[model samples]
Target chain A: MGPITGEQIAEKLSLTRATLRPDLAILTMSGLLEARPRVGYFHSGKFPHQIVAKKIQSLLVADIKSVPIVVSEKCSVYDAVVTMFIEDVGTLFVVKEGGLLEGVISRKDLLKTTLGGQDIQKLPVGVVMTRMPNVLFTHTEESVWSAAWKLITHEVDALPVVRKVAQPDGSDGYEVVGRLSKTNITRLFVELGEGN
Target chain B: MGPITGEQIAEKLSLTRATLRPDLAILTMSGLLEARPRVGYFHSGKFPHQIVAKKIQSLLVADIKSVPIVVSEKCSVYDAVVTMFIEDVGTLFVVKEGGLLEGVISRKDLLKTTLGGQDIQKLPVGVVMTRMPNVLFTHTEESVWSAAWKLITHEVDALPVVRKVAQPDGSDGYEVVGRLSKTNITRLFVELGEGN
Candidate 1:
């Protein structure tokens, strides 16, 4: 029921109080139950899964983000593809001078362009990239869980990790600092599973 | 210390046993310490991270795999890319008669093939696909952790979830049943963080 004494539980289960003490200790310690010196045990209303969730939510994107591969907005699609191959990343951040993010390009975008029969060697990535305002991004302090949520909700493979900077014109711009990708999330998943 | 009674521990800390019981309950319950009647408490040599690892490692590929997108090996590279877009999947499983896995193809492969300037409409996917025995796969019973490990180690975006079936010719062939991808892992990570 609401709260039961150790003796009552022992009697109900036909076991000695000594035999039940360890189990009660474990339940209380895990936050599944609350134990009091004189009072009985009360359910703590906490689940074991919450412990895992709490642990995961505490991790920041800054701790796990990978080095972002960048290309110039004026870079040819062919050269962008070459950069992608050289860096072995699925998505690339298109940046201007000072590493300010301009747009984002993905393998899917390049594939579609190639299928268009366009002259990829001459086509600037700016023509095909997802532009700055449309780009989804994360900050260094954002929780990895929220970043992973963005990746799932936006249905994008990666997000450029950015820092806000004032441009010469006094406009706010994002400077690419890192990258958060499904690959990074998967790697983190594996690392967590390995208890590292 | 090796082993000590709660009374002894409380005495050493200059706290009453009554004040120490809850702390002791939590430590013993979380398995940082082992409690025994008469004998007292001993270190359990368990870390909290191991709990998270054990929870993750217990998840299976079958529990989280997604429906696989498939195509005939004779399917054109152009058609394969179309199927990939239509199905909204980054990877495709190439299968032959009886739904046996023949090969695997990814957006990266299609992108590379598209960049080659070859006639994609006439180029069969089999020519560019990663052939069987070279394709990395996972079974239903394999741990998600191990499968995620495979994804990282092999540097593939997705894996065919398969079952070994006895062919009519007495050859053992893998029948593609599902797909496991970085997206799935990311989704799982998000779900875990949500405490679901």
Candidate 2:
């Protein structure tokens, strides 16, 4: 089929556009379809099963990333630990004043700090974090395959999903918007398996 | 529809029976179909997208769990750490002489032990592991949904997939045969999304 509008899809499904948006987004992210700003949606001509060999490369980050569990860089390690447990997430993104991506921390980092017998409440997570250069991140437009690969290769649980924005200093920096983890992928898998 | 055999499926797909066994196994694991000992395979009539809500209740742990990455309980924490890194897993199963799981060790545990400045070579992983009463496990016949739920609820990356066997001591215990992780679920999800 040629490009079809969301309105057309909604009509065909007999559901409101709002009700179908999420599913549409998932389909778009998985690379089954392409969406254009004003044109409409078009089939990618790639069958669903074809996604396996390509590693779901057509599914973009924007469709699957979840809101990030973040902590300010200046937050104490103790608070970071608490946040992690409270959020029930393995990794936390460290962000700056304007919510720009700063660093990343994992349970191992916190456990190491705790084992040091250092005052967790006094130590800033910034000091204990895997700093920016070492932090592996992904952009919203990038493929989920690459994002998942980073998780596997880097051996980390989560990735900060960000978008590049102009910095005040005339440099380019990433602004953290969401997070992606194995859980998100698994959840998506279950969704697809359920055929929903 | 009704009872079908692997040979039938293989013929329909134009694939040899040998080449189709693995796919059949995956389908059984995902609850798309069922296998009867001498009766052959039968359609479950459950669609793939429906798997999300039921969490793949029809898919058994035996169908999807992968080989476990294990370390001896008597092994040094340092060696355990090395094994974990080498295996590229976040958790390690500390098994006994006969390969019975004794405890579970995570990256956090090893890091904590390391940061304590304790001699990694002398300390056994058993001392740092989450022992018997606290370890979360799954039975071979149990559903993958429950396994996935345990992973999410416990906020752990992997689960020891086991089978109950009579011990020499006249008691019953679990024998680790495989492991189920977020990766496994995600991979399954990708496979399903690909319609493979």
Candidate 3:
């Protein structure tokens, strides 16, 4: 398709060029349209989702993951609650000896446990943690697409990125490397929008 | 690119046709790949986010918006809290005479108000409601992309889908039509994933 001039768009909409400038700026900045010095403007051939998907593809887990918020599996539910509020995160990665990924605990998990009226100070977080195999994870080489999918599908707010390492006993175990959350994705989205 | 046969893919991966069949079937059903009767299989040219974005584009606010969980502007904070919990929603639309959208009240707003230790049963929700020109909204004709963007950029969970209507006394006011929330977006994502 031929590049469209702002004049043409304004005319087609029966609007003044002044009235249309802001909307055009928004569309171009969002990557729905593109402008060239002399070539006028054209559709970017990228929809919002396409741009986001491309961004997700370009990002490696290592580039986007942050230090994981972790809790010892044996920590008390009360301690977990305090740690959660202190850390200001919605979920916590529960680990066993040597930072091995064991399970995950969410705000709801802690809330439900606390509401049970058990001795929160003595009750282990391990009892309420979402165990292995059920906990979703991403590896260093994986794209954020997979991580985001796990988030949307599992209806969870975060995932622990892990790496498979050989244990002292020669068994394979996952070591928590970092964490990925919706906040990271939103930050990336905002960055993408700036460049669009 | 030319279509590739299942046999070729299986051979390249060092797997039997039987072992690879189900995985191929899953990918095909997910809209990541396409199969032609005589031409074999080809990449579908749609990524995960593209599928989601397309779904968003095709959806109108009117189709997905839910009945607005609303409260009268004159309603007390205690009543608003009760209405929110009863409706099982995190936000409430505060309306004036004749259902004109006057303001918005969120759970956080109610919680903060209650924590002040004031008389909740007497203090009107309008006292704390986010008023006009501040409450973000969408119209029936708007796409889900615009709605979702408002959710992300404004960092709010729900939006009141509204329509501009002429007031009896001569100005214009917004009539709350329905509500759009993050849960709606996630539900749409799950639906897209099912056949993608």
What DockQ results for candidate 2?
Answer: 0.23
TM-scores for every predicted model? 0.81, 0.62, 0.52
Candidate 2 on B75-108: residue-level lDDT in tens? 9988887787677777888787677878898876
Residue-level lDDT of model 1, residues A81-115, one tens digit each, is 98998899999999999999999999999988888
Least well predicted 10-residue stretch by lDDT in candidate 3 chain B: B187-196
**Between candidates 2 and 3, which one is better according to DockQ?**
2
Per-candidate local distance difference test: 0.89, 0.75, 0.73
Leading candidate by lDDT? 1
Query: Once superposed on the true structure, which residue ranges of model 1 sit more than 4 Å away at CA?
Result: A1-45, B1-44
Among incorrect, acceptable, medium and high, the docking class of model 3 is: incorrect
Q: Which sequence of candidate numbers ranks them by lDDT, best first?
A: 1, 2, 3
lDDT of 3 by residue, B1-196 (tens): 4587988776655669998686567556545568998778876666554443444466677777889988888899888877875776768998887788999987657655654557887999988999998899999999766677777788776899998999888998999989987656655443333333
Best-to-worst order by DockQ is 1, 2, 3
> What clash pairs does model 1 have?
none
Tell me how many clashing residue pairs each candidate has.
0, 11, 2
User: Candidate 3, residues A1-196: lDDT per residue as tens digits?
Assistant: 4587888767654669998686567556545568886667876665444544444466676777788989898999878877876776667999988899999987656644644547878989988899997889988898765676677777777889899989989987899989887656554443333333
Interface Cα RMSD in Å, per prediction: 5.7, 8.3, 11.8
Q: Which 10 residues in a row give candidate 1 chain B its minimum summed lDDT?
A: B23-32
